[model samples]
Target chain A: MDFERLYRDHADTVFGYLAFKLQDRQIAEDLVQETFLAAYHGLEQLEGVQSPKAWLLAIAHNKLVDFLRRSRNQDLPLHPESLEAASSSAPSKLHMQEILEQLAEPERTIVYGLYVEGLTCRELGEILGLPEGTVKSKAHYARRRLYQWLQEGSAV
Target chain B: MSSEEYKELAWGLVYGTLSAEERELALHLVSQDPEFLEALKMELELKQRLAHLKRAMPEEAKERVYAAITGSRSQVLVTAVLKTVLETTLPRMLWPVLQILERSVFAGEQQ
Candidate 1:
């Protein structure tokens, strides 16, 4: 199924989502491997899939959820301060991270999928297992929150 | 439409999730309603800022994924070749040496 081409196309997307969510490049890289390996095994199923990027992202989202669950079970800090050192030092990236930190899950994932990954609401709905309407509402709320925050930040 | 619904439509417009009829409604509101116009403008700005967060996967990570998928096969091939060399060629090559050693041991014992 030309798995290499698939990976080449979506590796950044999968990694970006993981890195953004986990805030740890090393762990994100590990999960990227897991996601693609899982995809590799499921290559036959991918033939009829409509959007390969969204499909890969769904796998990535599940991997992240599993990792977070395992982490919670182990009592590991989900967002380690030390991991921030591993992220980009650019101001815009730091700012973006600061803004995203204010959001909770599903909203965070939706906003990221819609704005950053450029996925449609329907695609995000499929990935997040929520109805399209729910995704749109969450996106609306998240955008308003971000707008308010941006206005406040600018005021300051 | 309610302000909340317009807000949702504003976001839908920005994300390109709006249908033809919904998009028509959104644009009509944009022209007629100042609040909806402001909301649409904010959404566009927010979209741009959020898009700035997009990051490329590191080269090392990409290489690692490639290696992980291919490395297992390469490892198996290498193991099989080494096993064949050790089991077939090594034993065959060492048989004459073993015979020479055996004769030397017997000669020494007889002496």
Candidate 2:
């Protein structure tokens, strides 16, 4: 299945999504390997599938969730420099991250998929196992929620 | 439509996912509705802020993953070779030696 090609194509996007979701670079790195290994083993199933990128993303997302579940239900830790960013400069960046951390599961994933990963609604739906309409609706809700939180200066 | 509905429309506009008709409606709202404009502004700001959070994969991490992929293939090859030797050759070759060693060790202990 030309694993090298697949890795070269999707590795960065997968890693970026994981980093954004987990907010932990080290853990994201480990999970990236695991995700690729899983994909390699499942190559037969992936043959002729629509949207292979979403397929890879779905695997990465599941890996991230499984890791979170095993890790004692830990909250998403802020970035290491979050405090420094908050105090020294780039408070808005830290603030946005904190707000993202507070978002519920699908919403947070939705927002990350939409804005950060630049996934289309169809791709997002495929990765999330939701219908396209549902993805769009969730994206709408997530966008509204984020906007509302930013407007209120508090987590929604 | 209600303000909340307009806000949802505003989201579609900002995301560039709105249909042509929907975009027209949203644009009209943006022109006339202060809340919708504020919502649009917030959406744009959020996108910009979130852009700051997009991180590239560290180079070391990329190297580590590539190494792991290569290592996994190597491990599979080694396992297959070891399995072939163990299943077909090692049991016959080692059984007699193992039995002899076992007898020698336990024989002295019993004595």
Question: Best by lDDT, which number?
Answer: 1
Give the runs in model 2 whose Cα sits over 4 Å from its true position. A73-89, A149-156, B1-44, B77-111
Candidate 1 chain A, which ten residues in sequence have the lowest lDDT sum?
A: A78-87
Task: Encode model 1's per-residue lDDT on B1-111: one tens digit a residue.
Answer: 777677678878987878999999998988899989988887787777777567678898799777997676577579679757766766587878866876897799799
Residue B98 in model 1: lDDT: 61
**lDDT score, candidate 1, position A104:** 89
- What TM-score does structure 1 among the candidates reach? 0.72
Native-vs-model 1 lDDT?
Answer: 0.81
For candidate 1, write residues A1-156 as lDDT tens digits. 598899899898898888877777778888999999899878998989999999999999899889989988998664446356555677766677677877888888888887787787789988888999998888878877887887777412
Residue A114 of model 2 has an lDDT of 75
Clashing pairs in 2: none
Position A115, candidate 1: lDDT: 77
Q: How many pairs collide in each candidate, listed in order?
A: 0, 0
Residue A153 displacement (Å), model 2 = 8.2
